[model samples]
Target: MPQFVRKNGFWGVRVNWVEHLNKKTVYRRKYKQGFKTKREASMWANKFLAKANSGELVEQKIPTFPDYFMQWARIYRFTHITEVTKNRYIVTASHLESYFGSKPLNKITRSNYQEFLNEYSKDHAPSSVNKTKGLIKSCLDSAVADGLIRVNFSLGSQATGNKKKKLVVIYPNVEQIENILNLALERRKPYYPSFYIIITAILTGMRLAEICGLTWDRIDVENRTFKIDRAYNHLATDKEHIFKTLKNESSYRTIRVSHNLISVLSELKVNGSNLVFAEKNNPYKVPYSNGVKHPLKKIIKDLDYNLGDFHFHSLRHCHVALLHHDGIDWYSISKRLGHENLTTTLKTYAYLVEEDKIKSDDLIETQLDNFLTIGEKIGETSKKHKIK
Candidate 1:
């Protein structure tokens, strides 16, 4: 029971408890004054004692928003996430520091967070704003779990940003793709690995990181297939040419290659190096994906293809387009491209699918018309025979 007393013309309460510190028992007391009546003091003491007995009372100092966020990320996110993902968290921390400078995590209200996002969206793209918001929301969720904040202020917050239309997907046509492939094949040499990487990407529809991490052991020349299990971490800070697991389980797949592609890969393989796209002079190192862009641009210019913003990733899109042209289904294309689901392939190549649908509709109409015309001719011939 708490002891009640009257001091300085106000009622007060004193609560006592026993605590253990470093294997030593210690007695602790808490005092609260300025209550108007003994009943009020008694009520407050009961609540405080209940919290203390239940072990819910925490007396640690609260950290600022940015400080807590950085600490949370270091403990929970740094080791598990990629270098690029870590940079995004760091950037979000910087933004929090700029907006909430020295503000306690619990002191920031939902309105304050919404205002910050509103200001941030004025100059950033919608996608960028959304990413930042998502990162902060995750951090705030951890804060709530840690008993640092009562609520996640970012919940139900709306992110609005500069409205810029996304660019259309432009891939190379059949003639242009053939020209690019031929040029890459002619320029490919033992010392130049970009051309080889280009050819592999076009044939396999592999991401740049996957092609860079490809090894000779993963390829089966007899079966004409290669397995994708890992990828090169290009922008990693800890180590160069480090191999990392694929993005997801769907990304781990076996791709069948044509005989000609197998022949090309065989010719490029070196006796000592296991990597298929190793560096020029050093067989142990892999070339960066950016290294392929210059040569790819040159090829496009030489072929006079009018593709805008053409880059290394365009090869993957070109592969999809070629498969679509060959009358392959979306599910097959999705699997070939290592997509997580058929919906991803459909959404990404919706224009191509729409075009195919239009062509199919026209063919269906034409075939039906021909069949009805033939039926009418047969009916007229049968009527004439009956009259005779």
Candidate 2:
């Protein structure tokens, strides 16, 4: 029989192996998890006994890190998460297969993980390497939950300590955005859901998937608002499109349509059943998934928008940037952009570094006008004194 008891500030695992011939042997090791109540300790005791009796107790060494990671992906990840998310997990795992595949679960060390980060992630930005570390750590943590390993050995790795990712934060100014929008509107060739999808996306910082999910049913013409209840995801073409809740509960809020967006939707008012951005002629069609060619990038090139660092996601960035230029605070912008926190909004749209300098220069021009007017008045007074 295995049992649990509190010793000093910890709950300990206690096991008694029954000898069929005569005596019994008891072994115990205390873990540092402080149980607030006796019930929890009792529960641990019951579970320990069950595992010991079934011979399912976690051994000191059972599987290699490589072996356990694959098992974790199948047993824990695939059934629980979104398909797109599951695929991403698989992709993250696949990249790791080359490095830690043969290493034993019990043997992976801090130095080896450090070597991987220093040798590989040093060239990459701090943030990208940080994401890689999280995914890999999550895989290993699941292995810990599965009892394949006792402790998370990579806890102190350099990648885990990376402060933040250094993403390129170059958003277009107002004139640049207008130029891009006008350019997008000029495209009548492929019949982009230009009138609805492209305009809304460029104006509102909602994700590409969220724009694809917009339906006429959810639109409010009278109030000129749109609800974002969910985001449409079709990350792969080989599979069916996926429907998931908005980025989070906070993302489910309503967003006011811009005047231009309202007018465009008015122009797009066909008696449609499903999507505002649905395929025009084929009323029954679903929109393109992630694998399909996103025409925004191509349109930029066709229009000769020799703009620098302009990606589709930049349209979202531009939305937040324009609001920032209009003097919206980070908290308000964070809500509108469906960010979980202000920190995220700052990370994404905090590129207004030279704002004060630009404003100062503009202010100097206005002050110069006032200064010149004073000089004219002073000269008139001097002339009047001379006349006197």
Candidate 3:
């Protein structure tokens, strides 16, 4: 049986649940709120008891999809996840909320979810659609664990994400690299630090976040090495950004730098601030990604490099490409880039590896041709000596 209660200008229903577990009876009372009127509450209570008696009531209550996801994020995710990750999750939630705001978590069946994804796929990329589905599945997995839902219905979607063969790796050649360095030294841009940032990234292959988070204390001038242990989360101009943990374990590593870079760094004043690339006025803080991007674009335009869609990250790719061209081993490049796995380096620079293989083949063919010519000359001498 169930009972109706009224409080805080709202009506609620209280129902009892009993379960038999290993011959032991477990009893619990579940309460649900948000009824508009007492009669509505009474009707719900009656309906709940009937369902419970018939063994059709599985969960205590079903929450609206948006409401549950929002609550879950606030309670379980906000503190544990990184700021960037939290923002991504929030974006996913907002998109899902628009579609399933009023629907209960338990009511979203597999067919319903599949249909939703099918519609979402029409407007979004396969990767994005899959990412959204992944997030929803994660949220629903927690719901299943809490006994809030009988099963995660966000599973078994037939729409699959496209497999990415390789990431696009673009970088400047030797002549271009030299030209960039010369340009940086030659030009005095309005954004003073952009050139320095570009040069450092080309030399070190550090990510934009790592560059923003770099501090002088982490740099060893004598050893010619810099440690990358964290990344910066640039939220706003007025608000102070935070230095958070590195992307992964491998991202925290020490990379050797050049003596030329060392000399340049030494010339720059440490400026009462720890950040090497900190803004002029706010010496304690580094510029945001946009701050780096705008200057980089301007420099590319000024130099007339003819590089399309070139950004700060392009410098990192350029660094990797130069190293590969200089015959640096895959393992060494992976370590220098602070990649968690060598596979990442191998996959990223596969085109470079293919080029190296072609060179090797050419060298082998040239040696084989020389050996055959020598053999032919020996045979000709033998025949002439026999004839004499």
Candidate 4:
């Protein structure tokens, strides 16, 4: 029998073992200490009994880090996470394997993990390092739960690198956006697919993959709305292109397009691949991101917007900013953007709200100044009429 005990602020277990050869002749008492909690001690005692009953209570051969993680990916990951997310996890794990894959799981102490992160941060950006650290921590957490390790060594490890100060969101103003679209339309004539893509991004605030995923069948000409059930997954290797899921559950939505925008799309509809922005040669396959970016980069450089750091996703930000500037509420904007929640919408677009507040303050000041001037004029009139 085993039971939990606490002594000197430490939790432990005391167990009584009967003699194997002569149970009635002798009994032995044993105690184990230094468990973090009573529940941990109980779990340890339970595992001891279970393993003993199975006739294998001694130390077993432990797998190396890479082997264990790959085992987890093959056995567990597919049943839980999305296929896209599982691929990302496997990719991140592969990067980790390049470093500590040869070491046994028990040998990977907290200090060793931290050292690995430090080495990784030298070449990678802080965000990449952080994402890698997060995935490592998640994998180690599963290891802990499986009783393969006593603790998750990768927990609470921060990426060490020269992190850049967060940049202010860069988005084109209304005039600049229009000019960029016109450039796309003017250059790529005949079908004008790029022009349609740009207009769709501006009006819908969709990600590049989502824009490329759009098809003529999803559009409702009479209702003037379209469904966003899935997105183009260009980066996947093991899976087919065009995953039947978007970035998240909230990303599945229906968005209304303006009548003019709908008319433009309808005019461009032709007997080709069902995808609205499919490649010219392979209509079934969406155009590569670089194909979209090359022409857009040229347009931005021609306009001299000094937004070399910006990418196609900047169009989504510009859409949010335009809505914020137009005095749209945060909730509606979140719904329109298909954000998971209002917090995400606010966090990403807080700068736009701040700019709006500044403009509001200026307008309020001007109104107060006019009121004071009117009050002064009324006072002067009263004085002249002796009606003080």
| TM-score winner | 1
Clashes of 4: 0
Give the alpha carbon lDDT tens digit for every residue of 244-309 in model 2. Answer: 566566788898876667677555546353766655675434455432235666666675656555
Q: Any runs in candidate 4 off by more than 4 Å, and if so which?
A: 1-59, 73-87, 164-169, 190-192, 235-243, 363-388
RMSD of 3: 9.7
Query: By descending lDDT, how would the candidates be arranged?
Result: 1, 3, 4, 2
RMSD of 1: 4.2
Off by over 4 Å in 1: 1-12, 16-29, 33-47, 53-55, 59-62, 68-80, 141-151, 165-169, 235-241, 371-388
Worst 10 residues of 4 by lDDT: 17-26
Q: What is the C-alpha lDDT of each candidate?
A: 0.84, 0.66, 0.77, 0.75
lDDT (0-100) at residue 5 of candidate 3?
81
lDDT of 1 at 213: 85
**Per-prediction TM-score, please?**
0.81, 0.67, 0.73, 0.74
Candidate 1: tens digits of C-alpha lDDT, residues 1-388: 7999998889999999776656777777999999999999999999999887765663557899999989989998897776768888888889889999999899999999999999998878887888888778898999899888888989999977876632344677777787888999999886778888899888788998899888889998889998899998776554444788787789999999898987877766663578787764666577675689998989988888888778898898878877777888888889988999999889888878889889999999999999999999999999989954
TM-score of model number 4? 0.74
Poorest stretch of ten by lDDT in candidate 1: 162-171
- Model 2 poorest 10 in a row by lDDT: 17-26
Task: Give the residue spans of candidate 3 off by over 4 A.
Answer: 1-59, 70-81, 160-170, 188-191, 236-241, 364-388
Query: Per-residue lDDT tens digits of candidate 3, residues 165-280?
Result: 22333456777877776777665332366667777888889998898778788889889999899776676445355677787788989999998886675544544566777766
TM-score of structure candidate 3: 0.73
For model 2, the superposed segments whose C-alpha errors exceed 4 Å read 1-61, 73-84, 122-124, 159-169, 188-191, 235-242, 266-273, 281-294, 306-309, 353-388
